[model samples]
Structure formats: structure tokens, C-alpha cells
Target: MKEITIDYALRATWQAVARMYNEEAKQFESTMAVGFTLLSIDPKTGTPSTALGPKMGMEATSLSRILKSIEEKGLIERKPNPADGRGVLIHLTDFGLEKRKDSKDVVMRFNEIVKQAVEAEKLQHFFEVTETINKLIADKKIYVKNTTNH
Candidate 1:
């Protein structure tokens, strides 16, 4: 591991960002996951409960736990979705809207600072590289299996 790998860099940077967000969320007695969940819900129309997991790239069990916790905190409420009898819509309570604003501000501040520190061209390149990586993985181009046996 003399030379850093792309995955190592991405993982390290993500972990650092997660840690920073969690720390900032602590002031409001919340966690990064909760803040993220709050931001994911539609502020006005509400989001389908089933959609939250996939929308956040999170598993159902983890999202269920977060939803329960936030529900207990009075940040959100689940209501019957009129569009679908069996589906539930997750709506942000008034308190949740306030917290969502805080989360948005925290994220915006991070982006603002990063944009200020990094040159515009470099930042664009960074985004392009990440997008390429995502596309490669999505297309299953990174790891191909050999069918021929030697």
C-alpha cells in the first residue's frame, strides 16, 4: 500500500465528512443518519415510506430504525397515502422542517467552503472522475469474470 488507491481516498474522505456531519448534528441532539433521513423526505408532498430506503441508498432495516427513532423524537409522522391504500407517506412535522433547514445549512456550508478552497476546474474534474467511477460500477465494467479455464 505504498501508493494510495482510489477507493482508499474515497472511503477516507467520506468517513471524514460523515464524522464532521455527525459532530455538527450532535449540537441539535441528532445523528448524521437522522439528518440525512430528514433531508430525504419531501417537505410538502411527503415521500412514500417504501421509497426512502432506495432513495437514500440505505437498507430497509436501517431506515426502519432511523424512522422509528425520528418518529419518537417528533420529527416526522407516517400517514396513509391516499394514492395507494397500502402505502404510507412520510411527512415532516413542523419540528422536522426546522431540523431539515439546519441540515441543509450544514451541507451548504461544507460545499461553500470546499468550493472556496478548491479551484473551479479542479472541482469539476473531481466530479467528473467520481461520475465516471459510478458509471463504471453501474455498468458492471470494473470486474469481469473469465469463463475460460487454463
Candidate 2:
């Protein structure tokens, strides 16, 4: 609509999706962030603490809180990285792996539902638009400094 902006639409849609996931997560006594973090951690080799935040597009403090909660819940454990002595790797517990499977199913179910509801062309366009937005930000082309002397 002419009254709505792209950023607004994106934010609103994401918030709704997050709410949906969180509600579902509540059934398992977990939050969406925890489920997402569970899904992010590799089951076999684990993931570095440093890479987790960037990979998830999460801030350090937010990710830290989520990790702490997950750890307390016995879903994940941190171990010294063999490759890098200074880094810690987050490994999923057996319980964490089970929860991660649940998370993946939930996400896949959402995707399937969306696929059924939306046209393929529209979904393709959505992906293209998102790609363009990401590229613009990555390339620093979304905003430019004013060159003229004020």
C-alpha cells in the first residue's frame, strides 16, 4: 500500500513471525532465541562462541544471555576449542539435539505453510528483494554522506 513502507512491512512481518515462534517455543519451556541458538550450534563439532553472534545476526549481549539460559537448561555446553585454545565451542547436549530437531521442524512447517499459501512468483520476488536489501547494506549503498558544506 502507498501508506506502508518496506522497512515497516519487514519489521511488522518479522515481529509477527517471532511472536508465532515464541508462542510455539513456550510449549517446550523455551524461547525462540534459545531454539534458534540450539539449531545454530553444530551437533557434531560444535560452534565457536565468536562465530555464533555474527552468524545469527545477534548482538553480543543478547546472544550471551541466550547462551547462558541454554546452558543452564542443559541444552548446550561450552568446551575449550581444540583448534583454537582461546575460543570456546558450544556443543549441543543430547537434549539440545532433540530440541534442535523440534526447532527445525517448526521452521520447516512454517516454510511449508508459507509455500502453500503464497504463489511461487511472489516468493521468488520476495527472495530477490531481500537479497537486494542485504546487498545494499553490505555494500554501504543504502545511505550516503552529504557532500555539500552545510
- Measured by lDDT, the strongest candidate is 1
lDDT of each: 0.97, 0.94
- As for candidate 1, its clashing pairs are none
Model 2: lDDT equals: 0.94
lDDT of 1 by residue, 20-48 (tens): 99999999999999999999999999999
* Superposed Cα deviation of residue 80, candidate 1 (Å): 0.9
Q: Candidate 2: misplaced stretches above 4 Å? A: 146-150
TM-score of each: 0.95, 0.94
Tens-place lDDT per residue, model 2, 34-149, is: 88998888889999999999999999999999999889989999999999999999999999999999999999999999999999999999999999999999988979768899
Model 1 worst lDDT window (10 residues): 138-147
Model 1: lDDT of residue 23:
98
